[model samples]
Structures are given as structure tokens and as C-alpha cells.
Target: MKAMIFAAGLGTRLKPLTDTMPKALIRVGGKPLLQHVIEKLKGSGFDEIIINIHHFADQIIDFVESNDYFDIRIEFSDERDRLLDTGGGVKKASWFFDDHKPFLIHNVDILSNIDLRSLYKIHELNNSEATLVVSDRPTSRYLLFDDSLQLKGWLNKTNGETKSHFPDINPDNYNKLAFSGIHILNTSILSYMQHFPDKFSIIDFYLSICSKVRVAGYTPVNLKMIDVGKPGSPEEAESLLL
Candidate 1:
């Protein structure tokens, strides 16, 4: 299986620590966040992996080289000249998924115990264009889904902002789930990005076509995750590791 890791973010939320290092290099439980995600993916049967790098791109490249690419088919999608957001990054790396199979995408700063293999299996079984890992965790922004877990819309609770294709969509009628920054997408879904710019958010892309395609959500049981992109999250992630 193949997977792509989103390690190119500016990681502004981590401030001081990220000022000199890429967020992917931030150590949690004595391992770089990138290493954690890589090992997890490898354990889940992923053999080929590509990581996108922007902030301190050289440092990430050096780290991977030092580790001998973790003894797998590891490649780098360099974004040193221009950082592409999630959607654009994936589009740029679309060539890597030439096998025409569904591939998984993961965020470097997210620490989670969700079973990746199971998540991939679910995506294949559903034959969905994309399958996002989500949770009922409270958050300011959420992806709204129907009872069948098909994505319907997105909501920003702080500003009462909602984005949906349905003319009369009611937020109160759908289940609100927090996205986990992990998802699987079919290669066919890339064709839909032809109209998108070089820098776009994956969520926005999903919400724009979700009503027309099967963009499903998978909520894992006992899902424990931490967005290690904030100020004290590294410490918090250590406990998660324990």
C-alpha cells in the first residue's frame, strides 16, 4: 500500500519550537512526529510512502536520509519553493499514485491510535471517492454528515458559518463530526481538482463535491488522537504514547 504524509505545513501554532525546526521534526516521546507517523503507517502494511516537505525542508530530508529512509520505498515531494496546502500538495503528488489505487493521507503533527489498515479496508469496502477519519470530539469546526456517515456540509461554530451544496441544508439535522486529518482517497477523485487552484484546502475541495460523490466518514471506536501542532501538545502527546 502507498501513503502520503503532509509534513509541509508552516506549523505556526507551535511557534517557538517550529521557529527553527519543521513541525514534522518536533519530538514527542523521544521520536520525531514524522517518525511516529511513518512507523505507524509501515506497521499497518504500507510499503511505499511519500512525504511532502516545506518548512525546514532540508532538515526533514536530512533526517530521512540519516535513517536510511526507514528501510522502505520512501520518497520526498519537495515543496521548498512553494508550499501547497493539503489539496494542492496531494494534487502535485498525484503522479506517485499512478497505480490507480486508493491511497491514504496523514498529517505529520497528528498522533492517533486509530487502526490505519481497518480504515483503508473500510474505504475500499464502501467504494467511496474519499473516506475521512472523524470523531465526535468537540471542536470549533466540524464536518456535518448524514446518519449514513456521508459528508453533507461543514460548519464553523464560532462564526455560525456553514458550507454546503444543498440549498436548504439545516445543520441541526446532521451529525457533526471532527475531522482527524487522516483520510483515504481514490485516484479518480483527483480529476475533480482540475478546477481548483494551486493552493486549496482539502476540506473545501471535499465539501464542494461531497453532495455529488460518496465522501464518507469513518469513526473508529475508542479513537484517541492529539493534534500535536499546539504549544503544549508535545507533552500531551507523550502521555498518549504511554
Candidate 2:
């Protein structure tokens, strides 16, 4: 199956280093984060992959060209003109997938031991429109799910803002799970998005349709996942990822 890596972000959080290079090219355990993600996807049976580029686009392009895409079919969704956020990035690359197949979307900054094969199986088994990889981790933002693991709404812990797809129920009644930058989306989800211009996060799109769409959460908290977005976690990341 095909997978898309969201690597176009400027990564403001990882400043200094990101000032000159993209976050995907940042060194972690002696390898670029983008390289590690591609290796992981390759291990999980994803051959044809698409990567979005915006910040330091030429550097990434050169790096990939030099390595020959690690013997995998790699394609670029060039966004040097405008860096579309997650939702728009995926929409731009929608033409890469074929009918009767699902695609994987992952973040470049996130390193996870998530089982993509199992995630694809769960998504297919439940016939869900999209399966989001989530965990019961502490975070300011969370996606609320019902007892059946169906997406209910979203909660912002810091601001006390709550958005529910089901207007009748209180958000506090559902389970709040943090999103792990991983998603197994059916290509059909693209049909639902109308004309969203510029940049927009994909989570907003999910929240808009949680009431009617079958968006389920796959809990794999036991999996070792880390967001290497800052310099503080380098020691920890080196131990876990290397």
C-alpha cells in the first residue's frame, strides 16, 4: 500500500536547527527523522510513498535522490509554493492512490513502534472510514471517543474548550484520547472535503464529521512512540529509537 509522510511543516517548535533545515532532516540517533520513518514504512510493506516538501525542499530532494529512495518507489508532493497543513497536504496527494485501497499518513517528527499492518487490518475489519492511532497520554488536545471507540468530539484541556459532534451529549461523558500522528484513512474520505483553501489541520476535518462518519480509534498504548520535536528529549529519544 501507499503511505504519505507529512514533512512540509516549518517546525517552529524545533527552532534554531529548523531555522536552516526542515524538521524531517534533523538528526536523531545519527539518522534523519524522515529517513527513519521511510525505513519503518518499508518494513511494514509500504513500497510506493509520497512525501510533501516545503521548508528546505531542495535539500530533501537532493538527499532522496542521492540515496535512491532506499530502493523504494518514492514520490514528492512539492509544496514549495505554499506549505499546506496536514489536511491540505493529503488532499494535494490524493491522486497518488488507486481505487479499492487505503493509504497511511504519518508525521515526520513522530517516531513510533506502531504496527501499521495491524492498524490496516483493524481499519478494514471494522469498515471504518478512518482509523486514528491514539493513546491515553497527557496532552492539551484530545479526541473524545464513545464506549464503542467511535469519535465523539474534541477537547482542549488548556482552554476548557469542548466541541462535540453529538450536540445532545456532554463531552465529559466520553473517553478522551490523545492523537498519535498516525492515521489509516480510506481514500473515500477525500470525497467529503469540499474546497478548503490554504492550510488546515486534518484533525479539524475529523471533528467536522465525527457525528456521521465512522472514525474509530485504535489503542496501542503499549507501543513505543515519541515525539522528537525538541532538544530536551534527545537523550531519551536516542535510547528509545536507536
Candidate 3:
């Protein structure tokens, strides 16, 4: 199996620490955040991995090299010239997923106990073009899903803004789920990016295509996750570490 780690973010939320190092290199539970995700993916049967790097790119590359690429097939998707957003980062690494199989995309700063193998299996079983791991958690923004967990639209509770291709979409009519920053996407979805700009949020791309394709959500039972990019999340993430 193959996976892509989104580690190119500026991680502005982590301010001082980020000023000196990329969030992926920040130590949490005595290990860099990137290492935690890599080991988790490896444990879940992923053998090939592509990591996108921008901030402190050289540091990340050096770290990986020092570890001998973790004894697996690891490659770097160079984004040192420009930090592409999630969608663009994946698009930039499109060449790595040439096997035409579904690949897992994970955020480097997200620490979670969700079963990656189970998540990938669910995506294949549903035959969804993309399956986003989500949770019934409170957040300012949410992805709305129908009774069957098919993504319907996005809603920002803070401003009452919504985005959806469905003309009759009603935020109140669907289930609002917080995205877990982890998802399984089929390589076929890359075909939709030809018209997109150089940088764009993956959520935006999903919203624009959900009405035409099956973009579903998978909510793992007892999901525990922490966005370690936040100022104080690193400490909290320690509890989720095994």
C-alpha cells in the first residue's frame, strides 16, 4: 500500500516552535510528529510512502536520510519552492501514486488512534472516489453528509457560509461532521485537478465534485485525535501515543 504525508504546511499556529523548525519535526511523546505518522502507516501495511516538504524541507530530508528511510521505500515530493495547499500538494505528488490504487493521505500534525487499515478497507468496500475520516466533534467548520454518509456540502457555523453543488442543499438537513485530517483517495480523483489552480484546499476540491461522485465519510468508533499544530496540542497528543 502507498500513502502520502502532508508535511509542507507553514504551521503558523505553532508560532515560536514553528519559527525554528517545521511542525513535522516537533517532538511529541519523544518522537517527531512525522515519525509517528510514518510508523503508524508502516504498521498498517503501507510499504511505499511519499512525504511533501516545504518548511524546513532540508531538515526533513536529512532526518529521513539519517534514519535510512525507515527501512521502507520512501520518497520526497519536493515543494521547497512553494508551499502548496493540501490539494495542490497531493497533485504535485501525483507521479508517486502511478500504481492506480487508492492511497491514504494523512496530515503530519494530526495524531490519532484511528485504524488506518480499516479506514482503507472501508474506502474500497464503499467504492468511493474518496473517503474522509471524520468525527462527531464540535468545530467551526464541518462537512455535511447525508444519512448514508455521502458528502453533501460544507458549512462554516461561525459565518453561516456553505458550499455545495446541490442547489437545494440545507445544512440543517444533513449530519455535520468534523474532518479528521486523514483520508483515503483513489488515484482516479486526480483527473479532476487538471483545471484547478496551483494551490487549493482539498476540501474545496471535494465540495466541487461531491455532487458528481461518491465522496463519503467514515467515522471511526472511539476516535481520539489531536491537531498537534495548535499551541498546546503536543502535550495532549502525548496521551494518544502508544
Residue ranges of candidate 3 with Cα displaced over 4 Å: none
lDDT of each: 0.94, 0.87, 0.93
TM-scores of all models? 0.98, 0.95, 0.98
User: Please, what are the lDDT tens digits per residue for candidate 2 over residues 1-242?
Assistant: 89999989888887887999988988889999999999999999999999999999998888899998889999999999987888889888888877559889989989888888888888899888999999998899989999999998888999979877577666678899999899999888887765676577798888877777899999985878888875665457788865
Q: Who wins the lDDT comparison?
A: 1
* Model 1 global lDDT (CA atoms, 0 to 1): 0.94
Ten contiguous residues with the weakest lDDT in model 1: 162-171
Clashing pairs in 2: none
Q: Provide the clash count, candidate 3.
A: 0
Quote the lDDT for 183 in model 3. Answer: 96
lDDT of 3 at 17: 90
Ranking by TM-score: 1, 3, 2
TM-score (C-alpha) between model 1 and the true structure: 0.98
Candidate 2 lDDT trough over 10 residues, lowest sum: 228-237
Question: Every model's Cα RMSD, please?
Answer: 0.7, 1.4, 0.9
Candidate 3 residue-wise lDDT, 92-128, digit = tens: 9999999999999999999888999888888899989
